[model samples]
Target chain A: MYIVVAYDVSEDHVRNKVAETLAAYGLQRIQRSVFAGRLPPALVKELAEKLRRVTRGANADVIIIRVDKRALDTAVRIGPALPREGNVHLH
Target chain B: MYIVVAYDVSEDHVRNKVAETLAAYGLQRIQRSVFAGRLPPALVKELAEKLRRVTRGANADVIIIRVDKRALDTAVRIGPALPREGNVHLH
Candidate 1:
């Protein structure tokens, strides 16, 4: 499953925590506050629950969208050119 | 066709222009930098083209994802509650 997590957290610390958690889940930071990656269905739920825990208080709005990999591949990506495929560089 | 548009633009004026363009396209600003709504595939392409034109010679990165309505309906939405369905307020 392909997941996109976008958050609007007012508090800076909470926002940083949310970003860090998403990164820990192996999701790539596609935008400033948006992270996208491929994860198992079970993992998606787990990630959501974790996000819920982190955003218990404070003004935060987090949206987790599940999109198909094929759809994402054909996404109309504008601006700076990024790798069409997943980013991998470990030489 | 549910579409999600997320952008990271450094310039304040350019960002505002991008946001205004997206709003004009009838996409709801889900997060600070993310807008999403249902749109026709052709409209999506049109929106992309318009975005491309607006983002010329700027440090901007925009991503447009096409996802199913059902997937968006079942999205794991956390923090501040929003309408499960579309926002309708014309009283």
Candidate 2:
């Protein structure tokens, strides 16, 4: 499934660690606190466990919202935002 | 359709304005720079126009990804994140 991971952590260092973990999993950073990409359900489950370990005893929360790939390809772009995949070709 | 809006803007005020706009449209902030909610397609289009206008002279980008409600309900929650709705339970 395609997922959008968004984190809100109280500490900067912890936040960076969380971001790094997401990046390590090959998720694209779409916003300061958000990342998105496609992953198999098993990997997502693994990520959830990894995230739990990273945020242990910290005031942090991360949500991995499932996104439909079709929806992502036809993303409703606003402003000058460009899709990472240039060939998506949606209006 | 349910949508998840994520933004990256250059200026603080502009970013706040963008967030305010999203909030006014009843979107829930899931992270500092991300919001998610259900909106009619017409409202989503209207939001795209408003975002464009707000970011006219700014170096900013916003992407709204459509989400399936079933997908959302079965969100792959990670860390200590809790769903906003306490009743819509899932594991």
Highest DockQ model number: 1
Candidate 1, superposed: residue stretches over 4 Å from native: A81-91, B81-91
Residue B74 C-alpha lDDT in model 2: 69
TM-score of each: 0.86, 0.83
Q: Which candidate is the best by TM-score?
A: 1
User: What DockQ does each candidate score versus the true complex, computed on alpha carbons?
Assistant: 0.74, 0.67
Instruction: Return the interface RMSD of model 2.
Output: 2.1
Model 2's chain B TM-score? 0.84
lDDT of each: 0.80, 0.78
Candidate 2's error at B64, in angstroms? Answer: 0.4
Number of clashes recorded per candidate: 0, 0
